[model samples]
Target: MLIDFRPSGRLRGKNPVDFDSAVGPVLNALAAGRRDVSRMRVACDWVQYRENFRDIVDVRPVLPRPDSAESQAGQAAGAPGYDVELAVDVRRSGTVALGDLTAARLAGDDLDGRVYLEDWGLAGQSCIWDFNALYWSALELWEKASGRGYEQALPGGESDARNRGAARELISGLFTVWDRLAAAGALPEELYVAELGVGNGSQAKIFLDEFRDLDQTGERGYYRRLHYLMCDYSQYVLDLARETVVAHAGHVSSVALDATRPSHSLGFLRGKTFLLYISNVYDNLPTDEVAQLGGRPYSVQTRAYFPPGAATELAASVSAEPEELPGLVRRLLRLGPALLADSAPEHIGDTDTAVRFWQEAWSALRLEERYVPLAGLDLYSLAPGVSGEELRPLLESGADVRMHVSSGAVASFVDSLPLLHPFGRLVCHDLFVTKVQDYRVGFRGPGKYDGSVVNWVNGPLLAHAGRRRGFDVRFEPFRHRSGGNIMTMTTQPGD
Candidate 1:
């Protein structure tokens, strides 16, 4: 058995111990008496911090495909043939154990620590977020006043200050454009503004309030002709948003629609809508990360999340088997089961139990990542027939590229473009990374925010995609300050 260990990136400074020296003895202990241990490699992708490397462990399994010529050639050359991947994380100290594999705890500091098994990977995988249907399904439970969710989840909550600034900007830009279009007789009889992911509708209220003031003073009559649509996937959020925007009921309409596929429900608004607004929504959408390893492009494969101890009880209550979470989540979403009916006692049936379990499990969940080759990869579909290749230029960059595919964001942006009136514009504020190198330093997450997943959008890629579609795309710092992390992206029809 031959094992290869490669360090990723250059060493910035002195470390507690060198990568090879720190991990060599631990691997020896794991490999001892294991006949199946053949050729193995460890590509260190993170730097040691405080004598510990807290980073994702990437495990790629090279398996022979029955129909592939490459597999046949490899077999002829006496190459190993298996589709299993073993994840190894070397900590400063601890006994290593994972499903079917175990390593003895070493006594000395000859090598700094032990190699712990992080995950066992199969060859093929899908987007993990696609399967994470439970969190959104159970959203209503955590969106209440007592529930632990976003600041905008509850009714009567104040809108983010940045939202106020965004509203002011929208008013300024839209009013000027409206005047020009009205003068040219190009303006639609009825003006439209769509807000996707309208949490509690506070932002809508602020914008409406500002618009009304401007209309009464300016005598533009734009507000009289305005139609404000609040759209969200969750019916509960839509209801809450509607309540917050009740003052503008005459001009407002609420719809339960998937933001990623807005056209499905909003087709009637094609080329009529004046503005499409989104706030802190793109980061919550499902995304996939791809990397370029040694000049070869590979997709990052995700297994299920590992729950912390605090959430152990909740996780166990919600899912009997962690691997089957997607199916379980779908079932629970359809039928709110207080307990795993088949596994739990009959007395344990209450909806609150299910809701609590869902919230806790989400708070504790942390995704695991591995690398799979790009050949025959299950790239996430953007639109029904759209392929992920639209993002190839970004991921194919020479450096070890790891960036969010933002498939949903791309699809939403692409689909929303056609819905805009001639003078219409799309305005969105989100965590957007403008450079591929930003990922090389550290990719901005799949982080958990209460019950939601927050990932940074690949801004440069989205900008590139917009340009190809003949739209003028621009990115600037968020007008309202909560954090500099948020960037405002605007797209308008090309001249």
Candidate 2:
């Protein structure tokens, strides 16, 4: 895979290992601190390689703390995206190949303390063996006369390369963005999240499991408390999501909701405040010109499959100026949590990607005269909360991003569910905002990283505002995606 040097200065890579390879310091930390470190794991969904981490098979490296400030700071500080610190605190002083892994803050004499992370690098390529393992395993199977007969269909084989590429693209590109926000999602106390277009709940499962094991210490439910609500237009999908969460065991509550007209009860909506949300609905939304892309007729009909057909359909799930969004978000904040939503740019390939698609798509929508508050609204496009620094990469890379200022009603409808925020938001104690991301410049989308947008959304622009201020907000973007998103602690916004 090729590494794209981002205009933002963050080095872009093909996979996690490329990132780990660049940060050799983390690898060094592990080798050096062999004694004190209790255990460690790759933390992210993919497994990481340190020249020798595999040697210690019996030792299960605990999943790196998902929420932490030190980890989120580097990108906020404009460090290159491909390389970030794989931070961990140890009981004794030691080091790993990735970097100088060390002991955490003492916070007095308490043995139990939190570790602080900093930037580092490793020498090897890190990867997730699970995908291929599953794919290969399935291939071994063949249908039998009594039951069923068929060759095991491996998902990551040469035959499934396209799917694997799609999977990798989906994960490395889109998921990384979510990973950045997850840290904030971890910050909240009680959180409710929603999955907009949850396809068979794959991403939904990933996040639900994440929440099930949220960061917590010392007995008493060792993880933050979470109440999850899932919604999908597909009843079958909703059923799958419900089953997925329930089967996961002891940590999440799931429910179904509709994007067009949310069927969730006000009691549930009013009852629980939302924290973090990870949306991939845009993956299903249509990409067309709202009017024109940067004053141009931004229209492209790709042979590619487009997910969202129009904002109108998506708007169906929301109220234009939902009065409820703010209250729910505020409540979640008051309760303590954040949100993260995932969206792919309308046009996913080549230059002029989906810019014209969204621009034209919006204009084409025959919005109902009833006036949806945030739904069918795109004020965030004209006025976004992301910031000039933030928008810069998307603009430089010509990444198509359509900003929206969804009204309260629509925003509220979506806000009512429990969502997933990536690791970045959850790990940090405080948020650091910036317009530019070093790695973000690669798959760079168009637009200036607008702090105003980030600021605005972090404040008044969003519907989920607890009675107090907006939130302990922070913004860190990665292989950036479509639609604007926010990452908070346990509870942030949306439902």
Candidate 3:
């Protein structure tokens, strides 16, 4: 007789990570959740593991398939989009108030610094498991509050009141969208979930929590059973992820690797199939670069929105506009009549500022008209050291960068100087990002109404990066989705 532990997957029959037959006792001990290392031990009943990649010796989790999903269409696409659509058409695109537009932009920066990035950095550290003996014990408190299945946060109204509210709001928004996306085929799998620009592994924690199915005995592949992997360029951040993972089971950290070329540096990626994600990291990586997928199931999530000012403020230490944030938000709400030439018909007389604004604003508006595109277009661009901040400024200043609004035509192939290197397969999702120069995106005045500028940074990246293969992708019109782009397959890679 055998008592089974571990959760089921989208597929049936074989358990994705069950070591029941191989390490029966080990499974029992781990499920018991001992506090000390010596207290935990697994005893497999006469079953010996033959595989090298998975074994009871390690006492870790090894997931076979992707994470599970919950199917739900975006609840707001219909109503929110409809309201914004009418506002864009009748409100006089360039004549709106500019009072709060500046403030809104600055808030994006603040959000990045004080909120999103900072909290995430903290969550990545080893202290995560400190909440309770079981890593999930401490985390589950927050997960229940947010509606997204994340177990690593302190819930709202906890002793740490401020931390609790922040965790609740942020995780709730992120996971609700994420779970719905995975259910919709946007996220590949919960087990192999990867966040390309995982700021703090908050999203990764949700992915793993889902894989756990709220039970330790619920998933297969112990000793190799980790379900989510996070990567970040900053050691300061990745160190946190290492601590969190190692404390619960076992993990490696302090590895240096390039995002675009993760193949050479990413070790776990060696033999397993995985779901990949990239968020808020595009500006740091060159536009032409992409992670090489060797026939593995993966998705890239990116956030185009300038998260609320508090979120962007985490990087305030490195940003130039840290102090100007409050004042900028003040300008965003008003949108017009002052600061923008379009507010006054007579002011449209082509002064450099006004001319630049009109030109960029109109280009974006034209793309907005193409919101309901006639057909998919392949787009590509090649430039060096051009960051997101740089592009936004140029477009606002009237630079003539052409938005590459077509499908990329290059043969899909990974290049290398070392004679011949091989991989299982190659898959590509080439997203056509908006040429920041094309749109005079504004919260107000003659430009397109920015329900929010950072929407592109958040929504598109998270949405599409979570998009699975063979699934049709579309976004709400004028929702500032997709980075105003499209993702296309370029080739069938050869092994």
* Residue 262 CA displacement from its true place in model 3, Å: 2.1
Please give the CA lDDT of all the candidate structures. 0.62, 0.28, 0.27
What are the models' TM-scores?
0.74, 0.29, 0.28
Task: For residues 130-219, write the lDDT of model 3, one tens digit per residue.
Answer: 111121212222233334432221112111111233233333433454456556775433223344444445544444444344334523
**Candidate 2 per-residue lDDT over residues 1-495, each given as its tens digit:** 012222223233542134444333444545555533222222111211121111111111112123446435744774322211122222111233323222111111212221111111110000111111211122122112113211121111111111222234333432344344455663345444434445445555665444333332222232344445555544545665566666554555555553424434334445343322434222111111111112111111111111123332322233212223233222222221112011222212321322222222222221100011111122223211221222222333432222222222223323333222322121111111123232222221111110000111211122222212233433443222323232222223322
Model 2 score (lDDT): 0.28
Candidate 2 deviant stretches above 4 angstroms: 1-196, 207-217, 222-226, 249-253, 260-267, 286-474, 479-495
Error of 3 at 265 (Å): 1.6
After TM-score superposition, the amount by which residue 140's alpha carbon in candidate 2 deviates from its true location, in angstroms, is: 24
lDDT (0-100) at residue 282 of candidate 1?
80
Ranking 1 against 2 by TM-score, winner: 1
Count: clashes, candidate 3: 115
Better of 1 and 3 by lDDT: 1
Candidate 1 deviant stretches above 4 angstroms: 1-133, 143-146, 152-162, 305-330, 337-347, 363-368, 376-382
Candidate 2 is scored at a TM of: 0.29
